[model samples]
Every structure is written in C-alpha cells, then in structure tokens.
Target: MRRRRFVAAVLAGAGGTAALPNTAGSAAARPDSPARHATGHWQPRAPLPVGRGEVGTAALAGRLFVVGGTVQEGEASPLWASTAVHSYDPRRDRWSVHAPLPKPLTHVGVAASGGRLYAFGGFTDAVHLNPQPDAYAYDPRQDHWHRLPDMPTALGSIAVAAVHGRLHLIGGRDSHRIVTPHGSPVSLGFGTVSAHHVYEPGTDTYRQAPPLPGEARDHAGTAVLASRIHVVGGRVEDVGDNLTRHDVFDTRTQRWLRAAPLPAARSAGAAVVMNGCVIYAGGECRPGSSTDTFDDVTLYDPHLDRWKNLTALPGSRHGFGAAHLNGQAYFAGGSPTCGGGTSTDTFTLSLHH
Candidate 1:
C-alpha cells in the first residue's frame, strides 16, 4: 500500500471521519487576568541526519536521544520501520548517530531513568498493524542496547513517564489485525487500551497500576511534575477521535485525578516539564478536509490549573521527538505535514526566556 493510504487506513480505521474543533487559540483565561503567552521564539538547531516520524525521544546524561521510528526515503517511496538512533548535544549544537535499535519499530515509548534510556512497546512494521511487548535499555557510555523483560501487554503509541525511580507505561492501542490483506486496500482492526504497568529497573519486575480512567487512548502526551504523572490529549482509536481529557496520577497518593483538559485536542505530540510547567507541542489531527499537523505550543500550569500559549514551532509537525536538556526544550525529526512526510529540521525554545 502507498504511504498515504496506509496512514489513512491506520488513522481513519473502518470507514468514517470525525471533525475536531479548532481550539488552538481558545484557551480559557482568568477573567481577572489578561491572556498570557510564553515569551520566546523557536530557534533552529542541528537537523537530524535522517528524516523520520513517530520516533521515541528522551534525555539521558545531558544529551537528547531520538530512537526508532518510520522512515520514508522519498515522496514516492514506501515507508518502513527504522532502527536508527541519534543523540544530540545541545552544548555543542551537534548530532551524532549512536547504536541503533535491535529491531525496527515505531511509536515506541521512551524514558530516561537511572542514567540509561529505556524503550517500551511499539509497532514493528511500517503500517501500525503489529504491536510488540518487547522492551530494551540503552547505555550511552557503552553505546549498546540491552534487552529487558517484555511488557505485560502488547502496545504502541503509549505514554511513558519516569517518576519515583520507576517507569510508567500508560494507555495505548493493541489487538491489531489486518482487515484487508490484498490489493492495496486500507483497512485495519485495532482498539485503544487502558492497561497501565510500572517497571522497576532495580529489581527487574513489573506491577499492574491503575488503568487510565475515563478513556482508553493512545499517542497521549506525558510529563512528570512534582512526582505526578500527567497524561494529556490523545486519540481514542483513530486520529479523528481526538480527545482533550487530561489525567494526572500522583505518586504519593497512588490515585488518579482529573486535571485541566488541553485547549486543543491533539495526538502524537511531545510533552516535557519545563519551568515548572508541562509544555505540549507539535501534534496531528484530521480536523477538516485533510490531515492537519500542529505548530501550536501550549503550556499548562499545574499549580494554577490553567493553560496558556507558548512559542509556536518553526513549522508544523507530528510523530516527532521532544526532550528537555539544560535550559531548553528540543524537537527533532517529524513529518512537516501529516501522514508520511519526513523532515530533518530541529528547533529549540529556551525555558529561561
């Protein structure tokens, strides 16, 4: 199947399209306070050596790492899962290729903990038809990858966060099956899952955590704030079924609480904690006639329970990588448009601004 058709089939599912509201600039502001936006501009950085999308990203040892994802060689070329891994040193503003993944995969959840990078479950092929439970850890000092225990359930597009020295693998999609096996048809069977599992690296054990409340979704943005895990905006089953629900899990209380919803519904965005706030940037949705990528950057103030706008991306992108290192947030290697387009552009916004 063609790249566009494959993406359409994966995102549209059966045969229906759902329209999303345009809420990019509709964040609710306090009546007593003026509308607020973060002060800064996205500045260009070193581009990726190879363009890709749906990559897993995390910061480890003062450097940002971009892991496995889908790669498209050209406009007409077929998309395939990639094993390429690259690390960027913001201090030097340079990118260096590191040891690649053991296998090609996309939509893998990545997190940094214990001086190492961990990769969670993801799709093993070009199409989002195969979900795997495999897990691995990367050590930058050794430039190697070590296989870890598999997750309890197979998943892709999961939200991963490291809190209290444990890795939390949150809601994702599973139970994938090809509906049309012949003739370049676009059809697939899959559903969102609310399975939540926590992994302890020290003991190499897994424990079941509370499943995500309200909705079972995938491609949600996640960040750790004051030991609380915040999961925001994702699709229920397909990109058209975007959601604005925000759920927070407090490590101390071991309970889930509803937080302020995202101003705009999105999926496949990057989330990071910066300046004591959760910053979500660059997601994709099928809101109108075509697949639309986002450049709208929004910041959530957990203390105030409010959201405000932030500096927009240099270009719209989705299925990309975002990590915070030093005092800046870095975004890299995502589709500039939507579907299967690829880009090598990298941009950064300072948290100190």
Candidate 2:
C-alpha cells in the first residue's frame, strides 16, 4: 500500500512551537460548551513509565497497556531488541511492569478483543522499512502472553479496531525491509496494500472484508460508535507521505464509504471515540525540516460531516498513542523527531466548544 508521509516543519516561535494558521472555512460548529476547541490546552499528567515512541496502546479490562516502541529516532535498537511490556493505571496515574511480549517488536497495531489485547505487525528493528507478521495476545487477567496465528500478510503501521466484537485490520505497508525517512534511494522494498480483514474471536479466524477506498497505512482509526469503524488520515505510500482523506466502515454491511477529511493532512497519529465524537491527536506532517514535527489536533463529527481544529500539542509529536479514559482522550509516547525519537510525556485532551 502507498503510505503517506507526515509533513515535518520546524517550529519558528518560542520553545519550538509551530504556529499553524487555521484553514479557511466556517469553523466546525460548537455542539456544546466545554467540548474542546475553545480551550486549546492539554493537561499534563504522569508520563509513561518507559521512554519510548511508535508504541501501540489499547484499553483492556478498563486499563491502558502500551507495548513495544523504539527508544531513539532513526534506530530500531530498543524494540528490535527488547520484549518488555508496560501497563498503566489511568485511574491512579501509575505504571507497572507486566509479562513481556514473546518477541521484541515495535511499531505494532493493537486492539482489545474477547477480553484480551491483540498486537499485530510493526517494524521491529531500527532497520527503516522492515516489516513483520508476528501476532500476540495479552491477557490482563492472567498477566501472561500467548501466541496467535499470524496475519495473512506481513503488515506494519496497521490500524486495528474492534467492531461488533470483531477486530478489523486496515491498510498498511507490506515491505520486509527498512527505507529511508527522506524518501531516499534505498534497496528497501516498498509496496502499497489495500487488504482489509476482520478477525472473529469466537473462532480465532480472520476473514476478508471490503478494502478501504484508498490504500493508506499508518492512519488513525477507532470505533466512533457501535458497529461502525472510522479511519482517518494516513499515508498512501510507504515513504511516509501524507493524505487527509477519511473513511468509515459498517461491519453490518461489510462495506466502506467516504467521509469528511481531516482539517490537517497527517499520518502515524493516534485516535479514539470519546463523548460521541472521533477525536484524533498528535501526529507528524510534511513541509518539515530535519528537526520539527506536527503539533496539530483535529476532530471529526459524522453528524455534521466536517472536521474542526482544536488545541495543538505543546510540542512536536508523532507515533503517540491515544485512548479514551473516563470522558477525555489520553495520548502518550510519540516520537518528537521523525524517524525514531520517543517521548514518555502523556497528556489529557479536554474537549470543549
């Protein structure tokens, strides 16, 4: 699949804060006060116990578990080499070490299903374009690990969401080797895939489903509502290009449909459904120099068929993870710089009109 590269730009103002001019148009309607947009600030909380980014996170048994990400930028040493797993207690803002993954891998796509967390495909080593098909399951109840059938294809930067008790695996890169971040000439192979599949937990089997309208990977996706999965901005090429298009799939119909585009084009961001709206935060964009990353925040409303700009991250971030804890969305552990740098910082996005 063609992956879109997130634009990276240097922050010209104080403390490397990138100032983005709001795109022209009628601003997204304020459905209610205190719903975010008016308040452009994120509340800082306890940071991730481990300092890593490009990690995968999911909610299982009411707790957030983050797994396998690199410790530095442009190098896959940390993940390609470690199998450590960490669990977070959002209620108390604390972290605890848990049973490690069977293998050390990073850039994984994670989803909660059948009372377990399913982690699939990601770049495991510092090697840029390398991909893997290894899959694993984390059972919070037992605090243990188990292996599962590998995905039909080797995929990385995949987006996984549980719809109607089934796990939907979306578009991702299919290369088995690493590539340069600058889209430089390298032997690392690249291919765009449009395959979409759904896994049935009851039978431990995956079946083909309608592919996305476009072959974009490393995009953000979430179950904004029951039985519906919404996928937003992703790269169509493996070189990390950017695309703002969004799509929603109805499991009942096994079909995909076009929806609103993100206010800002992005890829490799995190997303979640909170308080009835699909909220996505912190990913990278292009037009960036060697140093900066995108700090933009965008929200999508299926009811209004539009996107609204909200608060930006305090600093540059990409590969950050996001999930709804309580009524707000909590995002953590993303690369401050493009290729491999990671941040342990965690923040809560307070939504208000």
Candidate 3:
C-alpha cells in the first residue's frame, strides 16, 4: 500500500498521469505504442475558455500560465487583452483564474524570471499595427501586476525567453518606412528586420544583441538548451511577401549561426526543449490562405545538428502555445486556420523515446 501511494504521488507531481480520471469526454495521455516512438501520445487536456491566436504562455513553479490573444471573427474583432490569467494545476486536473493583467494586450510575448511573470510588446486598443513596447510584470505570490520599463523599440510577434538570469528578446516586427535615394512611384521594396534585443532584470535595462541572419516576423519558434539559444522557422523575407526560414543565435558567443532549414516554412509556431532535442510545432504556411495552420511537428537535435519529422499533431492548429513539463510538451489553444479565428483545445505530447 505504501509503495502504491508513493508511486501515485510521484506520477501526480510529474503531471498526474495515473491520477487522470477516466472520463468519457476528458483527454488523457495514452501510453506509448510500439510503432510510435515511446514519446507518449498526445492526451486531451482542459480546453481554454475561448479560442485565440497570438497568445503568450510561460511556466512558473511547475504550473503553466497562459494569457493574451485575439478573437477576430465576423464583424466583431474582439481584442482579447484581458488581464485574466489562468493557472493550470495538473495535480488537481483543474484551472483557476488568477488576477487579470493590469491591462489587456495581445500578440505579446511572456517570460518568467526570479519567481515573477513579465509580458512585453503586444497590441492593445484595436491597434494591430505595431505592438506597443509597454511591459508588465505579474507576481503570482501577491496576485498583482506592476509596470516595467518599456522596450527601446516597439515590436510585436517577438520570441522571448529567460536565460542566465536575464530576459532575452529575439527577432520581432517593427514599423518600417522606405527612404529611397530619389522618390519613385514604386519606391523600393519593403525590408523586414532581424533585430535582437536583450534585457537585464537586475538593472532593468535593455541592450541590442546580434542581428538575426534574416528578417522574420510572426510564426517563429525559439528554444534555449545547454546554455545556447536556438531560433528556428519563421518567415525568411518576402518570398512573394512572406518569409519562412530557420536561424539560430548563440547567447554565449553573441553570434548568429544558420541551421538546416525547416522541412516546411511556417509562422506562429511553438517550440520546446525535450530529451536534448528542440521541437517546433504548428503554425501557418504561406499566405493568401485563411487559417492555413498545420498539425506538423519537427524535432532538431543540436548535438547532431539534424532534424527529424516527428509524429504529426493529432489536431491541426496555429498561433497556439507550447511548454515542456517533465519530458512532455503541452500545446494548447490558438487558431485552427490562418485568416479564421482561434481554438480552445489543449493537447499534451508525451516524449519518451
């Protein structure tokens, strides 16, 4: 009896695999099959309250926190900048709403450091243009939000991560205007940016890092492992007005290195580190197609410097979010298609082999 209790406790703390109640409609992670690499199969988890895309998510104290997104369907494009923060307690198989964000913002990127949550660069007040550089920090312990110094450049659709006790902000979109040597009716073509920014929490200051090899915005995925940061798969440049390429940046050396291109060029995807592999999942491919989100999942081994096509995601979606917890990757919410709206599905992929 004692041994059984200990095992149950261990599983519960490790994401409550066995404690997951057997319910007809509930999603549960399935044991690995022989054909499928022992990476556990995706189990359905609690769905988000609403379908959304361009959302932000971070992990704190072993709990997953997701916030900010948009619901643009029909004539009403409800800007979802709600301060409503949701906390998922896998141990209890439940989600509880914490204090809302100080302000509602969407298309923002979120990261966690020093036991606090920080959000930066998102759209607010119906401005889909460029995101405001405004920043906010949330204290789960105090159930409150506090403002932080704004970013030097206003940006949205950026990738953020906490590395070496500092917050690293990678490539993002900013307003660009053409300045031709001589004005022409057609001016020059638009040029995207690959600006990389870094923030120091202790000093509350921001600085410019190395630039990305290519200009990319939206749909990019990032991963930090073994003290190195990997930025992969997003739009490359205007491939007829869209860019889908892959690039990597080494924080230790402060330099950017090109990696093998993604099997498919996509945007708005999510990435996480598992078993020494960086996994990039979901997002829209190409343009002019409404909601062209894919259910594809790809894994890159930094040691081998190679990529493998993993099992496809059960459901297709993009603009969703992903995080790694106890060897499993949780992909939740976002739009099912490109131009369409968002989704509320929460799927978990167990990676064993």
* Top-down lDDT ranking: 1, 2, 3
Q: Which 10 residues in a row give candidate 1 its minimum summed lDDT?
A: 12-21
- The 0-to-1 C-alpha lDDT of every candidate, in the order given, reads 0.79, 0.69, 0.65
| Residue pairs whose backbone atoms clash in candidate 1 | none
Candidate 3 per-residue C-alpha lDDT over 122-229 given as tens digits, one digit per residue, 9 for 90 to 100: 766332444578888889888888888999877776788788888888766563533333333222222234667788888889998766654445447878876677
Q: Which digits, one per residue and each the tens of the lDDT, describe model 2 over residues 1-353?
A: 12334332311111211112123323344444233344445888787766777788887776777887775433334444346677667788887889987877777888887789888887655533567888788888898889888889887778888876778888777764345545654344355466788778778788988776654455455555677778888766532466776777767766666777787667777887776677777666555453456787776655556667777887778877877777667787887866556777888787665
* Residue ranges of candidate 1 with Cα displaced over 4 Å: 1-37, 73-79, 181-189, 351-353
Structural similarity to truth (TM-score) of each candidate: 0.87, 0.83, 0.79
Worst 10 residues of 2 by lDDT: 10-19
lDDT of model 2 at position 299:
67
Kindly report which residue stretches of model 2 are placed more than 4 angstroms away from their true locations once superposed. Answer: 1-41, 72-81, 176-189, 219-223, 238-240, 288-290
Give per-residue lDDT, candidate 1, residue 91.
88
Per-residue lDDT of 11 in model 2: 19
Which candidate ranks first by TM-score, i.e. highest?
1
Instruction: Supply candidate 2's per-residue lDDT for 3.
Output: 31
Alpha carbon RMSD to native, model 3 = 14.1
| TM-score attained by model 3 | 0.79
